[model samples]
Target chain A: MPLPSSIAALTAALSKLPGIGPRSAERIALHLVQSESGAVSQLADAIVAARVKVHLCTTCGALTEISPCEICASPRRDASLVCVVERPVDILSVDKGGTFHGKFHVLGGKISPLDGVEPEDLRIAELEARLQAEPIQELIIALGTDVEGDATSYYLAKRLARAGLKITRIAHGLPAGTGLEFADELTLSRALEGRRELS
Target chain B: MPLPSSIAALTAALSKLPGIGPRSAERIALHLVQSESGAVSQLADAIVAARVKVHLCTTCGALTEISPCEICASPRRDASLVCVVERPVDILSVDKGGTFHGKFHVLGGKISPLDGVEPEDLRIAELEARLQAEPIQELIIALGTDVEGDATSYYLAKRLARAGLKITRIAHGLPAGTGLEFADELTLSRALEGRRELS
Candidate 1:
C-alpha cells in the first residue's frame, strides 16, 4: 500500500534537496515520522528559522544574518583585494584554506548560455558598483575552471579593463594533495606555464 | 569562522537524520536557507505534519495515520498468518516481495543486551496479546541475520511456542540476483541445507 499523505508529502519535500533521491527521501521521512515528536518539531522549527533569519549580505551577497556580514563589515580585512566567487557556499570553500584575508564578492551565478544565465542575471552590476565605491586595488576571480567560468572571467576582464583595475584569476594546477602522475594534461600544462622562481 | 546561529541549528538538526553526515547536513541547510521562503516553509510544514499525524498502529505497531493501520484493519488479508519484523520500515521490505498476503507485527527493535534493549522493551507483549485475541495460526519471524536478531528470534520462538502455534523463520540463501560464486560460505551451506524437492 502507498504511504499516508503526510508521509508522502514529507518524502516529496525531502527529495527536492540536493543529494537526496526518492528512496533516501522515503527513508528519512519514515525515520522522522517514527521519531519523537519533540525532535521532529525542533528540526522543522530550525529549518524555518534558518530560512527566515538568514539572508544575503547587501555588501557582498554572502549569506548572513546581518546586512554587511562579518567579513564585509570588518576593517581588518584587506578591502583593496576582493575575491569574486560564483555562490555564497564558495566563500566557505575559500575560507577553509585560511590563507586569504581579503574581502569577497559573490557573483550569484556564472554566465551559462546553455542554462539561459547571462551577465545581467548575475551580480555583475553590483560588482561594478563595488569597484567604483570601494578603493579596490586588485580583483581576484576565484571561479570554476570550466567553460562557463572561463567565459565569465573573460567577459568580466574585458568589461572592467577600461577602468584600469588589476584583474587576476586563481591559478589552475594539480591540487595540493595529488601527485603529478594523477594530474590531468590540462592541469599539468597550466602548472608548467605558471611555474614560479625559487624563493 | 563558524556558521551563523540559524544555519548551524539547521545543520545540527539535519545531521541528526539517518545517513546524513555533517557535510551533507551543512549542504542541505545552506540550500534551504538560500531557497525561496515559500518552498522552505512547505518542507518545514511537511515535516511537522508527518510527525504529528503519523503514529503507530495499536494492534500491529506499524506506522499509520489511523489507530489499527490499513493492514490490521483490512479483512482481505490472511488473518491466520502474521509476519513479524524488527522495525516498521521492515514492513516495506516484505511488502516489496508482493507474495506475502498476511498482516505484520512490528517488534520496534531486536533484543540487544549490550544496548540495554530487552524482550520487554519490544512489542512482544503486544504480539502475545494479538495471538490470544486474533485467529493467528502461524508466527513468521522475519528478523535480521545478525546475532541480536538470532537471539530475539530464539527467545520469541521459545516463549510463544507454548501457545501451540506454528513458528517459522524466513529461509536464508543466496540472494536472487547473485550467483553461488558471490555467495559466502555460510550462505552456500544454508542454501544447500534448505534445498527443496521439486514435484
Candidate 2:
C-alpha cells in the first residue's frame, strides 16, 4: 500500500540511521504500517517520550531516561572503579561479560584525526573533572582498538597517569571459542604479545 | 536540537523501515529535521501522492501511478509475450538487460510448504484468467532459484504445459564474474545441468 503523507514523511525521516538507505527506509515504513498498529504508535510515543524524557547522564555522558541514570544511582556499583568507553553500546558488551561491577563513562566518540575530530571536541573535560572530583582508585580504559582508539587511549593514559590513579589498559586477544587458523594476523600477534605462564 | 512532537512522531514512524533498528531511526529522524526539509516533505508528499494516485494495475497486479501502467499501456511492447516475475524489483533486473520488451505479471510470492504458503494463496487465478483472455504466445518464468522458487516454477510449468502455451524457464548458471573454482556445490551442479553446446 502507498503510505499516507505523514507516514511517508516518517519513512523519509527514518533514512538517517547509520546504514539505512532510501529503499530500506521505504520497506521499513511499509512493514511498520502493515504489522503493528500499536507498535507504530508506541514507536511514535517512544520517540517523543525518549526525546523529552532522556538526556545524557551529566556524570558519565551516557544516554539515560533519568538524570543520574540507574547505573549511577545504584549503590551496588563500585564508584571507585570506573570503566571508560567510547559509546553506550560498549557498555552492553562489558555488562554481558559479568566480570565488571564498576561504573562507566561514555566519551561519545574517539579522537579521529582524519575525520577532523579531536580530543578537545569529545567529553574529555568532563572526564578530567570526574577524575578530580570523584574518589576513584582505578580507571580501566575499555576503549576500542582502532587507530583513533589507540590515540585516545595513549592520550587518556598519559593524562590520568599523572593524577596518580591506577590506570590500566584492557587486554587485547583473540575472541573466545575462535579457531587459531581463522584469527586475524593482528589479533594473533596481540595474543602472542600478551601470553602468560600457564602455571 | 529537540524535535517537536509531530516531527518525533514522524521519525519514530520512519525507523520501522527494513534494516533500520532503533538507533538508526533516531539518527535519520534528526537528519531529516536538520537538512533537506523541503525534499523530506516532498518525499512525504510522494508517499501520500503515490498512495492516492498509484493503484494495482488491474491487468498484471503491478503497483502503478497509472491504471494500466506505462508498460501495459505501451503499444510498442509485445502483447503476445509475457514475463512472469515474483515482485516489482525483478522488473529492474530484466529491464537492465534490455532484452524483454513484453508484458509482465507479478506473482507476489512462491509456494513454501514449510511456511504454509500455497499456489492458491497467490495470483495464480488472475494468471489463468489473463491466459484465457489474451492471445499470449510465450510465457517466460523468471523466479528465484530457492527451493520455494523451484517448487513454484515446477508447479507453474506443469500447469502452463497443460494449457498448451510455449512455456520456457530462465536458464540457471553461475553468476557473471564468479570463478568456476570457487563455485559452490549447488551452483556448480546447476551450471552443469544448464550447460549448452556452441553449435
Candidate 3:
C-alpha cells in the first residue's frame, strides 16, 4: 500500500545522517538506483569493512585498524611533543597542514558542563596516564576557541603545568588570508595578544 | 606514515557521495568507528544487500528488490491513468502525498538538447510501447519547472496527445504557505493564470 518498501527504507536510512534532510535523502536514494551498479555495493562493503576492522588506537584514541594506529607505530614522530586535539577529525586537519612532526592525542570531546560533558566524560584520564607513562616534555593544546574548548584548554593547562610539564596552548587568531575588517573583535584581540616579532 | 590504509581508503570513498566533501567524509568515517558500532554494520550490510538485489521496475521504473515493483504489480492502482515523471524520486514524493491512485512512468531524464539529452536518451520508447499494450486513458506530466523539464513536457505533449486520450500537465503556481510578495514574478503570474473559480 505504501511506496516500494526498499526505496522507503533507503530514504529513511539516508535521512539519519547529519545535514541530510528528507529531500536530499530522497535525491541520494534515487540516485543510488541509477548510479554505477557497483559503486553503491562498494560503498556498502567499505562501510562494513571499516566498521568491523577499525578501532580506536589504545594510546591516542584515534581511529585505526590496528591497536596502536600508524602514527603511534611510526618511529620518526617526536613522542615527547604531543599535540592534544578534541576529536579524531582534528588530528587529520593538523596532519594535513604537514607542519607538525610531533604525535597526536584525541580527547574525544571538550569540557561542556552545559551539554552534560565533563573532564571525566572525555579522555582526560587517558591523557594523564599517557603523560605519566611516556617521557613527554611539551603538551600542545590544539582545541577550538569555543566555550567548551576554552574551558577544556584551561583545565588541561592548569593540570599539566602543576605536573611539571611544559603546556602550551596553540595560538588563536584570525586565520591567514582573512581581512582585518572582516575579523571579529575577539579574533582581532587574540591576534594582537598572540603577536610575536618576526625574526 | 598515515592512518590505516583501509580507514583512509574508506574516507576517500565516502567523499565521492553527493554533498560530502573531504572533511565531512573524514568525520563520517571516524564517527562510524567511535559511535554506533552495531548500526554502522547494519547500514553497511543494508547498502550492499539493497545494491545487489535492487533493480528498476520494467513497468514503472521505480527501484525495487523485485521486478515490476509493488505499485506496478498492484491491481488496485488505476493502470489507465499513468503519471509521467522525470525521476524515481518524484514517484515517491507524489506517493507520500497520498493524492494519486494511478500508476507511474519514469522518463529517467528530460529533453535537454543543449545538454545533449534527447527524447531517445530517456525511456520515451518504453512509454510509447506501454501506450500500445495497455488501455491508457489519461497521461499526466509532473516534472520540474526547469528549462529541460519544460522542453521535455512540450515534446511529449506533441507526441503523445492522441485522438482519444487526454494528456495534461500538472498546474504550476506559488507553493502553499508562501506569500505573494516573496514569490518570484514568473511563479506568481503562473499561479494567477492557473487560478480556478470557487464554485
Best by TM-score: 1
**i-RMS for every candidate:** 0.8, 7.3, 2.4
DockQ-derived CAPRI band for the predicted complex in model 1: high
A38-94, model 3: which lDDT tens digit per residue?
888788877778777877789998877787888888888998999999987788789
DockQ of each two-chain model: 0.86, 0.12, 0.42
lDDT by residue (tens digit), candidate 2, A1-199:
2334444664576565457777776666555544444654555444444444546678886556566767778898899999999976566568778889998898888988799998888888898888898878898998888888889999998876755688888998888888999988998899999998998
Score chain A of model 1 by TM-score against the reference chain A: 0.94
Ranking by TM-score: 1, 3, 2
- For each of the candidates, the C-alpha root-mean-square deviation to the true structure, in angstroms, is 1.8, 7.0, 4.1
lDDT score at residue A16, model 3, on the 0-100 scale = 75
Clashing pairs in 3: none
* Model 2 Cα shift for residue B181 (angstroms): 8.4
Task: For residues B1-199, write the lDDT of model 2, one tens digit per residue.
Answer: 1233444565567555567567666666554443444555454444443344545577886656566777778898898898899876566568768878898898879899788888888888898898998888889999999998898998998877745578887988888987998888998999999999989
Q: Write the per-residue lDDT of candidate 1 for residues B16-89, one digit (tens) a residue.
A: 99999999999999999999999999999999999999998989988899888998889999999999999998
Global local distance difference test of model 1: 0.93
True-vs-predicted CA distance for residue A13, candidate 2, Å:
8.5
